[model samples]
Target: MGKSTRNVKNSFITLSPSFFTHLLSVSPFSTPNKNPSPNLSLLFFLSLSILCTFSGICLLTFYPISRNSIPCSALSPSSPLSPFLLASLSSVLKDYSPNTRNYDEPDLSSSAMVPLPARGVAANPNISAEGRDFWKQPDDEGYRPCLDFSLGYRKASSRISKEKRKFLVVVVSGGLNQQRNQIIDAVVIARILEAALVVPVLQVNRIWGDESEFSDIFDLEHFKKTLQADVRIVSSLPSTHLVSKQSIENQIPYHVSPMWIRARFLHQLNEEGVLILKGLDSRLSKNLPLDLQKLRCKVAFHALRFASPIQDIGNRIAQRMWIEGPYIAVHLRLEKDVWVRTGCLTGLGDDYDRIIANERDSNPDFLTDKLNIAKSARRLAGLCPLTALEVARVLKGLGAPSNSRIYIAGGEPFGGKQAMQALMDEFPNIETKETLAREGELTPYMKRCSVLAAIDYIVSLSSDVFVPSHGGNMGRAMQGHRAYVGHRKYVKPNKRMMLPLLEDESVSEEEFRSGIKKLHKYSKGQPVLRNNKLDRDVLAYPVPECMCKR
Candidate 1:
């Protein structure tokens, strides 16, 4: 065994130089030297071929090195090799060591290969309890919210001729954040069509059966006032235009350009004088022009203010949380509907799996994931919602104290209070809207899901730290809102990296904790510009666009 190990080490040493040479030969610097000597060139090529042959033999003899067997010094930064070469070498080695691979190591060839942490683990684990103060304000990253719509507004207003200023009506449906997104898109669409927008009609929620109107949930007057300069807003369609109204039958395609919108609807709008769009959820493109994106930010952060009653109750809950000291808001998306829709097993064993399976069978349309991925594979892929136990473990691993105040925000979890037992045990100082508010305080909005979600939204926005067990509209909205207002610390759980570590029976507690910390070091709610090329939602990562450096 010792002799074999020695041979492997020697082989690796011998192969190293050939690998480095190969890299150099292919690099940009490998441009042919001028005035080359024929004899010297022949000799160089001959020697390079021999070295490559030797390297191939070495690789064949001992390619897969065991993590435990390899000496750390071989891969250390102190080596003579440049950092880029070292990184490349490490990546090559990593591709073979699947069993003991470090997921934290980024791929040198492609930055896109780096795993983004799922939405829950904190950025740093070393900060004290008072670290809450660190999140109250934006990071010192020289950027602030600056929605400059002056140019776009001028251009849009100029295009809106008296004959072309048609009326646009949108019927927005879904939960609070979904509707909020539609509302934002509705404004942008109105600008695209250069039409006066009628107050958005809120489709009665099928699940909650709540008949709350847009005016009931959001301050309509404020919405109109905030966009008065950008788009024309009206309470209702004009009597003459109502008869000429045309409802769009086909659902709009996702991520359409402004030109596509104009091409599709301009003629209809001109002919009919009014056009109605329904289920306008995520139909508009996320990668709109700067003005449109800024308008989205403006609508989301500024225009879409909650109604006074909802705001008052939400503020009361948030204040109550603050009184108990800084609290963390966790958007735990472990509801039954979530499980049914995601087709992800609850990790609560066979009985719970059967429950989810039965629900999925009863309503096949509920399952959003079309691909039939195994439950275990889905969990490993970070598709499953983190259970209460998993959330508790993540929080503890991130150094949140047992006494840390946590506010659970979401619909009732799948298993209800029983499902939350683990988290409650881990952190006793946990509260929900049901717990924080006085009896009958939330009674009015108890059945109103959107209003209740608005309450959760407010509390979440006020939190010193925000964590989402699953990614959704609310989480995405909160992420963008927090980044826009101030870079409040948001802990996106490194689920893809973390779940495997957590599941590995061989991993010790210390190893798991360290792994979790390392996975999320850069996953905090730091200021990052939205990459439009990647087609990431601007609302979730607004920087340098809606924001400007002072």
Candidate 2:
């Protein structure tokens, strides 16, 4: 974790008056008691004074540094830049020292220990120094350092031996309110990488940012430490503009937050790699050109994990909403967590409006302009009208009882308490809760359930089947083995063609067409999704007997 050194400060022999005389025995000039020529005497005294000062400075600077210890000044709160200086001085001393300890001693016990700098890729010897200096940045007045009071020194000095130079897995969340599946996807990927996890604790602009959506599955305090270790940084909202208002920025204790800041920071993030599975449905996937498909794959494998859903949550929640004997988890997603917009309006303006328009189209009633249309369509298309009717139709076709209790868990499409009420109205027999009180724990209802993780699972398991609503990231995550459906032609085009609309406020039909030509071309036939099912290799667990029963 630190450089090794042999020169202990207390063990060094001090140069006393007797020692200075002894040193003169080995030098060209002998020590004189007094000089006769005044000019010559003055020049000799000046040279001696300069030599003593230089020697003292060199000895003092290198002594403690040679011991491979962070300097005392670096540990003090007042010294902001001393940590970097101390590390630099230690490196210099290590280079010049005669007796250096070999950290590379070959031992079977040290196999788990992090390796020293080998041939090409150098171990970051300065990570500790950088971390220490990061801690030294001014803490806000009212803000006590959230880090351990002893500072990051202890954790910074200790190295957890791993087989490779590990990378971190950061999850950039849109917000806590929406994108629970994306959060789950982030968690699944973290497990895959065997890396620590963190979320950007954010202030709410749209939904309650503090809402603990995935608390049932993960730990928060442990999450915070992961961020401190630079293993992960999950943000609720990604700001394109890096400028932070002075007052807001000053609140940061270590002056660190959501912004990883630049491409280099992203490049340096090897210890934590993200599997950002976005919500691209098969319908959209079919319409995308091979290049766009390649782009999606590149982002999935290369940059981060990009994924989309084969079915919407509205549909999934409906099919799996079992409130009685069989309790099921029905998670409804109301917002897009990862902003997938191409250009300017990706997060703002009229371009933003179109994005919202496309999202709202999941509700047929939303297409019809009622506030409850999204909710109505959500219920009708999912379970109550469509699924219920489909259940009756299936029962007629198969001859089984059509009586079963279902549970639905979700927020309103229009957003908040009012929307929940509309959903409750759709199915009076089913149990529904606007907000479950289970904080950081799974509810009792979810535990009792031998559940359908999604509608695709339900449809594959039971006789009731309906086409899924919109492209969903959660659905893709749940497709363990069952076949999936996508609306390639029905769903709108990829987000790339939408970029020009952001660049121009008023886009004409011809201009839009011309711009669309810039998009990577796709197979022009029926635009149906191909290979919509999950690749068997990607499942986290074996496909259970219940899932494959059909």
Candidate 3:
């Protein structure tokens, strides 16, 4: 699924010389003189040199770059064939001569085939002159799910009853993870209020910059089937539930995730039979009771499922993992956006201010109180995922076999190639959704992070061992999901201990391995989890207690 540089280099080797041969053959210098005429040859050489000066300009007219193309060095101003004194072009008479180069498809390939400036975007096309143009992502063996699953949803066909006024909680929120946690709260809230729960309106998250519907990313049918017994959900507010526009003008404004929202208040404080709720952000964990936490397991692990195409892709990847002996599905949380949201600046020099400033401007709806949280506190609270280096060390310390096939699931990391250098060296068998699925297959996901994350979630859930670099939304969700799916082992790094160990000069490779094993022994397959603190310490899959045997 990726273009190899070897092919491009071989193509260039075949063409660079022939083009030069054609150039010299059409010139006066192509003829051999019986008697060497210094003056004549000098005059001919000077004229040819003058023509070569503007060769790059003329070439651009023939090979116009639509997106962008790396410039060919043959026509460059500094090229030896261009009559310029190029120190790097030492073999001017042989390699860089007009008589030596002959690249085919000159009409299509730019002079450099990269580094060429585009119409709008600034570029130094030569930047890729020495390296491959694109990253190679490979496909994995196809496999089906362990069990048949259907991502289905049923349409709501009823309006609120006029005779009865049940509490209909309207949760206006955005973001996938935040909304998910709030849904857990909403379910419990609906139960407490003895109200008919309206199907959550999964509005497009401004922060996520996506236009997907709840149904587009998830199997609402599965969600409904799982939670139908505990709470009722509808697609929209019933026709009878709406109030006149005049009534809305005087309604109380939604307080967001109102920490004080109680079931008793549902009936006691309804304004004209409709309550408007907004800012239902879910950073706090105390709103839901123990029973609600158990319900969260049902909602998050069992009720939620990915849309069909994504699940299929994940299943195929999971099957590869199953066949390939074992694999580590790592949640590589190195996206620039998440770093900006956390305002962490350990190694991200000048990018720190820019990222934070961009987030503040783009996401103005953020909880203002969360802005001042310290970086250490964020890490402690599992808000920050490990940096590429930290994750590498932790995995290495955990004695992960270097030959293990690691599936990297998440967004494009921040440091790019520079960041992945060490981690990739340690484990070369890393794979991603892009490498495992074809473009047409991925078309259904539409390049959305949430959709891709669903694929990551499924793959990680079924992996031989799941490793989360951070305790972020995906990590927490997968850890819990893997739990419900029969206690698959999950590797939770003891970051507090591991970081210090990584810094110590006395610690050997063998010692690091021992520590990692010791740290994670109780972290996986435990029976008591759905406690949110599972992010911070050793508590695990709540399946045994929460889910009864089928």
Candidate 4:
């Protein structure tokens, strides 16, 4: 070693003849120290620091200034800017960050754990019919022009005094959904007729074997108060009132018929002072006047809110789903009943046909619709519910990322593990009510099918993206609700295109993605949703009644 510089411990640091002078110029001990320059000592340390930095070693440079040096000891080297530098470096090395203080770990825990649906339960036909539109006609998809609801709510010419009694009775014979719709029809008709509606009698459908009454589920008092101004409502008929399975008289006057004539004629015919309107038929969704349609919106969206308890559970689950991030609620409705009735399996082998035949034989009453429907017509009308496997393929192909948190909202998805096997790989986290709530909590809702469906319906209304697998009662209801709550993203599947596309396994991943992208492009916004058909009711978020946009 040269006399000017020497090695310390086992390592040596070299400095050129002029390095000592340069090191002193930049060193904290710039002023001459009482103990001398200590130039060689500072030079060795500075060189060591430079060498260690290039080798990826983050050496702590803030060791206190040397005691023997005056200027070095006078100044403290620590500064506020050093933390910023440390944070930047720590961000690059997040996985290996020394502590959590440097960063806020993203709160994805709730979304990471989705409420799981109870799979493999065959007894639960009580499942929500989320994505099934059982009522679409061939012309259901025809063009729908924009409506000017701004002026749609003009006062009707027939607003008679509430003191007049236009007493009416209705028979609710269908299951939950069909009857729910029928009630809306009845209320709208009663309002039209300026009638005092008797609390409707819910007949026990022998097929279901349940004897639940309307008061068992619906808030009867709320229903009365909600429609109070429009129509006077009572819960039951007097002993003198006659009951009939069929309409007591056929010609109920429509809006085009003079209201005065309807009031006078109906009162004249029913000498008993009450019109017993039987057979649940829908008039609210038909070609009604603008004022009535707006009124229907009011009844459906505003007045028909579920009891707070059902809404509470649904909101809690929804909040959990959204806590980590927003998620999609996929209306998965490929139950056994939907499968056989739709005849969507026509082209598949006899195994499917035999399976369908067996179901039909076991339950002759299951296939309610007697229409001679062709598979093509069913395809065009989107009658068929997609199987779980088909859904998985569609979702994967749609470019939904693996991290997507989806809730499967419906009854037991058909085919179980075999069907969901593909979807599990694509979306590892899929949950349901069984996963979210305890069995004890759901027991009360078991017999209340419509309320159970309403729970799912409420969750769906608050979803980031609602993908209905079949066009069913619950699906349509929530789709309408979503529109009312600012049209948050409702994706109506074009089953005509999706079914055929999924069976082709020959397609590459790129091709699959592109196909899904094109298919879903239609469902992203207001075009399909805005174009409300004569039958379907989601018109660009509820125009005048549900949403005022203020």
Candidate 5:
């Protein structure tokens, strides 16, 4: 240690030679014990107080300060700022570590627990179809365009009129031409929704539908006078066709609002107060309402009193009307390319010359090689199956036996003709289109065949499987049929994705067999089963073919 300094404990604190000299020079008890010079005594005492205060502060800063212990910085030896800073810092540290005061250990019992809601069945399909559509087609995607309704209402709300109300049904006729059967269904749904106040406005291509037939259903003359309580059908200039939006609006009548029409027409209506009845743009089967109660309610509330099902119109023809029997309603779509390239009945890559040559060269017994080619070749195979001739031949050969009648519904007239001839040739007892068309239209045929009921079995080629088409109404209709049938084995192919063209190339027979196995397993032993919870949730009560049941 230095002569004038020493280590006390672990700290080296020094009393320098100069510090002692200065202390001695200004000592109050030295000499006559007179008070030293005022300046010198003040400086000496201040310096001594500071040295002691600093040493205390160093100790306090490094260690925790208790409430009772006043930090040296807070209570400065000769000033007030030190005490203030110390007090502020002490409060800051205390507040920062408030948990330090927590004496008891944390209760671990409640830490791992998660609260769950006490609610009925976690999934319910009985909710509104509007909500379902919204969930399926999110807002981020323009599937359901975010309509700006701020000018009208801040928050969109569903409104149900207590008394009677007026509803506008906009029929959007775009994309592929809707099957006549499908159109009628859409119309019926619209009438069901509005009851007596539903007005139908058909917006189709300039040259799409038959105006006379449309007018007969809508009846514009009677509607003008208000004598007709049924839906008023009108054909306005399409908004999409016109370049100007305002121009399109100007063309529409005052009675019909294009906004309401478009909303209902595009299936984009969100059930904001007014209910919109979307017409047949796409297949209703494929995009069926997940919430069926909402669908039924919407239909019941909006449809007109005298609205007719499209099937009725088709069935009205003077055909042998079999209500429920054994039959097959075959639908063969006259695919555009199939007709243009193949010359209607002839197969693809064959023309009139090729047909005539084939007919002449083929065996006398099989003189109709051209006819056979026509029936066999297809534009969109799997989508619409082969002609009735081919289907009947295959079915008969497979041993469908006697009483089976194949009613060809849509497609080329020649295809239907060929099928009728084949059925007549194979099973003379079999009923022809003339015989069945004499009975009724598509629906009656469908009903008779037990296709839509609990049938013993549904055996067909690759095309006719569950949900008809991929993400199409065909699939949905199949589900509906299965549900209606109670519980049945839907004997369909397993992995064979039944596509339109390239049927042989796209899916293998093995895959089709696998799918059939899976479908059979699901169906169990019943002729039908109601498995689609989405459909059952909403369509539990008033089932289709209700009349046939009672």
Candidate 6:
């Protein structure tokens, strides 16, 4: 026997004698009997001995032990316990004992902890076949995009003299949407400083390795024309200021007031005549003056038009999607980088988890949540991205038919097609850019990530129903854009509310569907004003400030 098994047996053996003695001492039969007979005493002892033996046998049979510690082959065929009995006992022990593990059994601990459905399977097997009216457009709620900052807004050109005209050159970094945000903020910052804004430079994407310039993605002439009255946007800095340029190395703090901007940059800009700012992403304040915020809306919605080629292809894709009836655009942000950076579990099993964990370990700074929350707790708190299974369940619950055509935006998911298998299984009629476009359509922009993202953005903007699986730059941009155009059907998953219900195995299909419907009643592109008190992004929730009610 192994050391652990021997120790267990020895401990039980040592305790057995004392246990019997204590039992006998506490028994009423043990009380002194004056007329006790020898035969009766012998029979009583025999009965007690038989009972003790049976109890010991039962204890041994049910005793929890490491399955590897004791070999089943050790028991001889002639032993009192039959093979069937031994197998039954093993099975019982396996069910009850936490430590007893069968190597042959699949590891369910991860799934149990996560509470997500199996790969390529819906969360609820019995999905409702009844179709939902996803075609109905959401109520506009009397709101319309009104970028009317004209009343109190002064043009920067009229305010700043030509002699004191300082040039502001900004280098915007990050992904497509992030860069878009930075570009909007750059214009606002230039207006704040009363400086001529040079066309913001697009930082080379480190991951994508695409050296795409600003002109490559956005229409240069249209951008300049749209903001001609607000600020002077030039292709390059003036020759006089080129040699005297000052670069700001430190990052500007978030939510900085206009006064702070003037105080910090006005004198330096005047002296140098040219200021170069890098890493301008989220550097500008969220709660700028109404005019600046309006300016922001104008820049984001109107000024920043996609390049001709990208626009043409994007419009073509959007037209194609529209031709096939109303289609749902799903911004499935399941990229490996997203998983690593957000520290969100992919629910693709332990292998993917290990891959993410490995990447996270290597680049600790990439993790968005620095709180060091537990994975399960993070998932429960809705920090994790909705898995393919979860997305399928949410759609089904929201009344999307099995035959609903889905246009999946965003890049290739972590596990490629396999990651999207569940969603495809739930709704087979799905199309992505590659599948939708012709052979030579996307050839030129094949390696251009930003351009590709722009294509997706346009298609998403025109989609009948837009569903973002997680909150990110793209989702936020789309939310505001859809609202600005008209309240299109946008479904923001109630992850915090829906995750617990999804994890709950006890919730029936009907109950799950009802719960989902209830959770998302007010979430479907409802025209609610942005809560500025909460410091919500105006770009994401552009309602009262950027919109006017009819």
**CA-lDDT, candidates in order:** 0.73, 0.28, 0.52, 0.54, 0.31, 0.74
Our model 2 lands, by Cα RMSD against the true structure, at 23.8
Per-candidate TM-score against the hidden true structure: 0.74, 0.28, 0.61, 0.63, 0.35, 0.74
Candidate 5 local Cα displacement, residue 332, angstroms: 3.5
- Where model 1 places Cα greater than 4 Å from the true spot, the runs are 1-138, 150-152, 158-165, 532-534
Q: Report model 4's TM-score to 2 decimal places.
A: 0.63
Stretches of model 4 off by over 4 angstroms after superposition: 1-164, 205-210, 238-270, 281-285, 346-353, 362-365, 368-370, 373-381, 414-419, 527-541, 544-550
lDDT of each residue in 331-443, candidate 2, tens digit only: 33332322212111122246544665576454333232234433334333332111222222221222112232333422233233332443344334443332322252224
Alpha carbon lDDT at 352, candidate 1: 84
Runs with alpha carbons beyond 4 Å of true place in candidate 3: 1-169, 172-175, 245-260, 268-271, 283-291, 346-384, 529-550
TM-score of 1: 0.74
Candidate 6 per-residue C-alpha lDDT over 1-550 given as tens digits, one digit per residue, 9 for 90 to 100: 2333222244334334444555565444787567655576566677588668767766765654322221222211234443234322232123333444345322221111010010111333344434434445667775655544443353234464232468888888889999999899888888888888888988888777888999999988878766665777899876777674355645778677889888988899888778888877667777777777877877887778898898889978877877766578999989988898888788888998899999999988888865578888888787878888999999988888787788999988999888999999999999999888998999999999999999999888877788999888999999988876666778999899997789899999999999999998888887877764647788888888877664
Top candidate (lDDT): 6
Ranked by TM-score, the better of candidates 1 and 4 is: 1
Q: On a 0 to 100 scale, what is the lDDT of residue 280 in model 4? A: 47
Q: 1-550 in candidate 1: lDDT tens per residue?
A: 1333222245335444445565555443466667544565565566677668776777755544322111222222342544234323243233333443234322212211111111222345654643443343335375555544453354455355232358988888888999999889988988888888889999998767889999889988777765665677888877787674355644788778899999999898888788888877778887888778877876787778888888888888887887655678999998888998888878677898799899889988877764588878877778878999999998877767777789999998887778898999999999999998998998888789999999999889878789999888998998888776556778888788887777888988888777877887776788877873548888898876677665
Tens-place lDDT per residue, model 4, 420-460, is: 56667778888777677765877877766556666676666
Error of 1 at 74 (Å): 53
Tell me model 3's lDDT, rounded to 2 decimals. 0.52
Model 3 lDDT tens row, 290-399: 34444454455445566666667777766666565456778877776666666565355566546666765777555233676776666555456687777777776655
Candidate 2 global TM-score: 0.28
Task: Name the regions of candidate 6 deviating beyond 4 angstroms.
Answer: 1-132, 155-157, 160-164, 532-534
Candidate 4: worst-modelled 10 consecutive residues by lDDT: 65-74
For model 6, the local distance difference test gives 0.74
Instruction: At residue 461, give the lDDT of candidate 2.
Output: 21
For residues 25-44, could you state the per-residue lDDT of candidate 5 as single tens digits?
56554453455465866866
